[model samples]
Target: MIEADDNENVERLRRIEAVTDAALSRLDTEDLLDELLDRVRDLMRVDTAAIMLLDPHSQHLVATAAKGLEEEIRRNLRIPVGSGFAGRVARTGQPVVIENVGENDVVSPVLRDTGIRSLLGVPMLAGPDLVGVLHVGTLQPRHFTPDDVQLLQLVADRAGLASQARLTMIDRTAALALQRSLLPTRLPEVPGVDLAARYVPGHEAGIGGDWYDVFTLPSGWLGMVVGDVSGHGLQAAVVMGRLRSALRAYALECDNPADALTRLDRKIQHFETGNLATVLYAMISPDREWIRVSLAGHLPPVTASPGCPAELMSLPVDPPLGIGAVQVRHSTVVAFPPDAVLVGYTDGLVERRGELIDIGLDRLRAATQPDDAETVCAVIMTALAPERPADDIALVGIRRQTPAG
Candidate 1:
């Protein structure tokens, strides 16, 4: 009988470990906690199981997931540090076993009312930090053995790691959404011009400060801008939005691309200190015969005429925005013949680790330059970014439509 009992205990622990592994594999934090609680309750033959996660800002343990507990109790429960059973375990970063909760003053009235006579609580530790608490309760008075405590602690460790990853993913997802919201949802339609744009986020970082915009100016000229702010994540995205708005306002007031960029540079220098961004702005005339381009420490724009290969235009480059008020900027005018295509893009399109920028530029020039704006955009993206790129990419292309006979 002794041997049989020992075998049974070992099998129960094996099952618990298996379920813990499954829970850790879940992507959603809440779902993983819920599954963990359910598995704990069943594997330990306990009446109830729950997981309480610490709110970093509030420093309170909130019940995130639970099994076999009243919905009202689970939703309304908040345990402060060093207070209740779970709180004490979280505060001390150790396991606590109660043979009889009714006799313990630390047990909350709500928990006592649920007929939980005995309980076991363990801290979920991720390295040196205490992430949360995991607890199980029984209706009848029962003693929790050392083996039970050890098994629960192991499960808690796994849960803590999974929770941390889930939180990081949630933060990235929110940042990406904000970045997308700030970008232009659709390009404005310009007469005699076909427009196409693409924004591709990096695989690892998820979002960065790459932006593109196309709009019609007051003088019936089509205005286009492509820019890249230094750095990645939410802060860079906020700076990009501010710069984009300021450039649009300046572009509307000034006819020359260089003048608008100069004003934008001054605005950035005065307001956003230490923030630098490279930008290329172009203004296309209403007749679609000429385009004025200006560069602020950015890559030169590319032009492709009918029956000719795509070539990068040579233009004088100035300092990027937010440098200072002294840097001089200038504009270069180029003839845009019929059935010509002009493209502006961020560095992500032509940048690779451990390679020269000229190599990427050569690849970009070799890409198929179709007459249709959308086709050219698709072809460039396919040729340059076939997989998850290491950096964010922003591309804007304008093709002059051939006049109908």
Candidate 2:
């Protein structure tokens, strides 16, 4: 028979090996917990085991992985901080072992249902903060020795690493969903114009700094704008969102296209990182007889009316916002016959894999030709979309009202 001392040593070594293996596996949190619970059950000779992670916002301990526990109980169970025995361990950032958990007020009946009479739980910590709990339970009344506590503590460390990884992934996914939900589902219908919009984020699915929006003003003018924040990812997305919102508010409240952009710059400066962005705004009348367009360090859109050849239209730009406020010129032009399509785009559409801004603008000018609004937008995207886009791409197209049919 193995001596009691030798048995303890063997168990300790086995736990050390388990933790070492877990660290090397780099398994994501879900799989890591499965392995952890399996190791805990074998080492402690327990009937059941589980790992619970605390929801940062809810402050509730919810089990994420388990063995030998009722699926329903594990799914629905959540203990508030300091509510039950496990909760107290999480609250205190310590370990606790109860020999008769069935009789302990701190033990929930959900746990006792598994015939669990003994319980041991330790905090899973990432840095100094308690992230979750690592727990083992036995059906029969028994004592958890000091060595058992130490072994479980080691496992708790592994759980902490896994918890951090899982939470990060979850957060990024939710942020992306929120950003995508905020994007326009379809372009607005302009009576005389065909509209199409596209947004392509980087490989990470993060909100790219690019954005586009179109809305009809009460004055029967179709308000349009496109802007690009200086960088990429969530920060850029936030700036893009703020710019779009502020522009909408300004467009609805003010009729002057230049003044609307000026208001948008002031609002955006308050929230944007570095208070910087390149923007283009235009107000088109319902009859498409005139357009009042303004630029703030943004790419001027391409214009081509029916029966006319395509050409790039350049507008004077106020330097990008947040750098410093400069006088925005009033270079509003009237379209002859009021029947041209206006395309607004970010620099991503024209910039090459490694090239200068002027080069991209030059390419864009070269590419423009008299074509349908949708065709023009599609062609620009196809021409500018990189083999592997390093940044977000956004575009909006509008055409003046054509006479019936």
Candidate 3:
């Protein structure tokens, strides 16, 4: 009989571990917590189970996931720290067991209505930090054994780690979506030019402020831009979006790339005081014969003619935006022969840790030979970007189409 009981205990542990693994695999916090609560309720043979997470702003434990409870109670429950059963567990970082809920004054009236007679609450802790609380309840008054408390604590520990992981993933996903939304969804078709642009956020970095834009100007010219903001993650992305909008507004008002960048510099100096960014702005003429380019502490554009290898075009460099209150920005016009491609990219394309920038530039120049804009962009990214890049990359390529025979 003792051997049979040991086997049963091992199987139960395996089931609990399986449920915990499943919960950790989910990226969505709501779905993960819901699954965790359901599994805990089933595994413990309890009438109901719920999970609560502390709201940083409210300083209260809010019901994040619940099972076998009324929808109103599940959605509207909020227990302040040190107040109710769940709150006490969260505040004290310890487990609480009540043999009879009717005798406990700390039980909320709303929770009492659920017909719960016995309850056990454990702190969901991530190391030394209190993440939230996990609770299990029974319909009839019953004493919880020490083994039951230990099993519930094990689940709570896993829940804490899983919750943190889910929140991190959700934040990363949201930031990435916001960053992509700010970029040009579709490149406008120019009369005699083929344009292709790509943005790749760093694998380990979540998201960064790398962006590219192509739009038709009021004078029938095409405006191209590639930029990198000063930092990574959500703040950098926000600044990138603001700068992109401001640059577009400036580009629409001026015919020259230098003048547009000049205005953009003032806009940044006045509005975004501490933030800084590198920008490469170019205005391609309507005939596609020439491109007027301006660089703001950004890499010079690369060009490749038919039957020739790619080479970087040396252009005048200016201070990056948000540097000085008054700045003198300059532009240089380069000949854009038919069947030639012009490439603009952020530093991430060519810069790697402990390596000279010249090496990246040489690699980029060598990769840009006599290809369509799409092919050139793909080839450069595939060649330069590691499986998990350390910085965000943005590439914009434009090719003057060859006239049909």
Candidate 4:
């Protein structure tokens, strides 16, 4: 005959393993917590279980998920960092087990209404920082054990890791979706601009730092920008979003192309990143009389017109933003004749393997000859055929329309 206590102990250990395994299986926090709270009720022999997560502001712990609490209480409850038992556990990074909650001062009066007599709470900590708390409360006046607190704490630690991972995934997904939406849905129909643009996410699973935007400026000038931050993945995507939004705002507010970029760089300095970004900004007007171009550590743009063999615009500018302090010069305005074409691209287009960068540039320049803007884009994409692009590529081609006789 087996003792009741021994059998219960074995069952509790089995439930602990199950909860930990379930939490580890999920990379997302919300899913992990859902599984965790369900398993906690089973493991602790409790009526209900809940998981609270620290808000970004860190002022209060919100009930992110619950297994058995009423919809009304669960929806409305937010425990301040030092208000209840769970709050104390979060603030002090300690585990608390109340054998008799009716005698305890920290147990929330709200839980009393739920008829809970015994409660256990554990801080969910990542390293030394506390993330939130996990708790289970029972209706019967039960004797909670040290092993019970330890088991919940182990689960809480796993919950912290899951939460942080999910938070990062959410942030990257939001920024990438917003970035894609902000980019031109379809290339604008400009008289002389042949634009072929492609945005490739980095080798990693999340969003890439590369982006391009083409739109009409206030003064009937066509604007184009292609840029790449130094690193790949989420951090870069965040900075890219900010830079892209600021550029659009500045372009509307400023008069000159260089001034827009200069203001953009200054606005972004508030948030520091080791990653540097290379940008090429240009404005083209319909009159076919002039083109304003500027470069900041980006590949020099190629301009080719009939009778004028392709030439690279190699104006010197400061290194990419975040390399160090930078000062931008006035944009160089070139005399554009009728039916001229200009192609602008990121370094990735030129840095493909199996051929030198110069070879790629020559190939691209060769494809830019006596064609309309759309045909020019198709020709270059064909030249770089098979589409095995390792790095992100963005290209914009602008051509000036010939005036009617």
TM-score list, all predictions: 0.66, 0.63, 0.67, 0.70
Off by over 4 Å in 3: 1-49, 54-62, 67-153, 168-186, 200-202, 229-243, 256-277, 287-290, 305-310, 316-340, 370-372, 378-391, 401-405
Superposition error at 85 for model 4 (Å): 5.2
Model 1: how far is 58 from its true place, Å? 11
Query: In model 1, which residue pairs have backbone atoms overlapping below 3 Å?
Result: none
Candidate 2 segments exceeding 4 Å error: 1-13, 20-168, 271-275, 305-309, 324-331, 334-339
Candidate 1 lDDT over 1-405, as tens digits, reads 999999987997687666657535844777777777777777788998877878775888877777866562546678788887888898888899989775564555557767788899999877888778888889898899887897788778878888766766765777688779878888887788999999999986567788999999879999999999888876788888999999999988999999999998888888888899999999999998999999999999889988898999989888888877745689999999888899999999999989999999999999847478899989999999849798899999899876861
In model 4, the runs with Cα more than 4 Å from the true position are 1-13, 16-32, 56-60, 67-119, 122-132, 138-146, 153-169, 203-205, 228-245, 270-278, 304-312, 319-328, 335-340, 347-393, 401-405
Q: Order the candidates by lDDT, highest first — what do you get?
A: 1, 3, 2, 4
Against the reference, the lDDT scores of all candidates come to 0.84, 0.75, 0.84, 0.73
| Local lDDT at 12 for model 2 | 74
Q: Go through the candidates in order and give the C-alpha RMSD of each one to the true structure.
A: 6.1, 7.0, 5.9, 5.4
RMSD of 3: 5.9
On residues 240-297, what C-alpha lDDT tens digit does candidate 2 reach at each position?
6777777888888887877887777676666553757888888877777777888887
Cα RMSD for predicted model 4: 5.4
Give the C-alpha lDDT of model 3.
0.84
lDDT of 3 by residue, 1-405 (tens): 999999989977776675668535744666767777777777778998888887765888877777876452546778899887887787788899988885464556657777788899999888788888898999988799877798889878888887876666766787798898998889987789988988888987768888999999878999999998898777788888888998899888899888988888888888888888899999999888999999999999999998777889988888888888644789999999999999999898898889999999999998887678899889988888777788898999999997761
Worst ten in a row by lDDT for model 1: 102-111
Candidate 4 lDDT, 143-172, residue by residue in tens: 878778878888888888778667767777
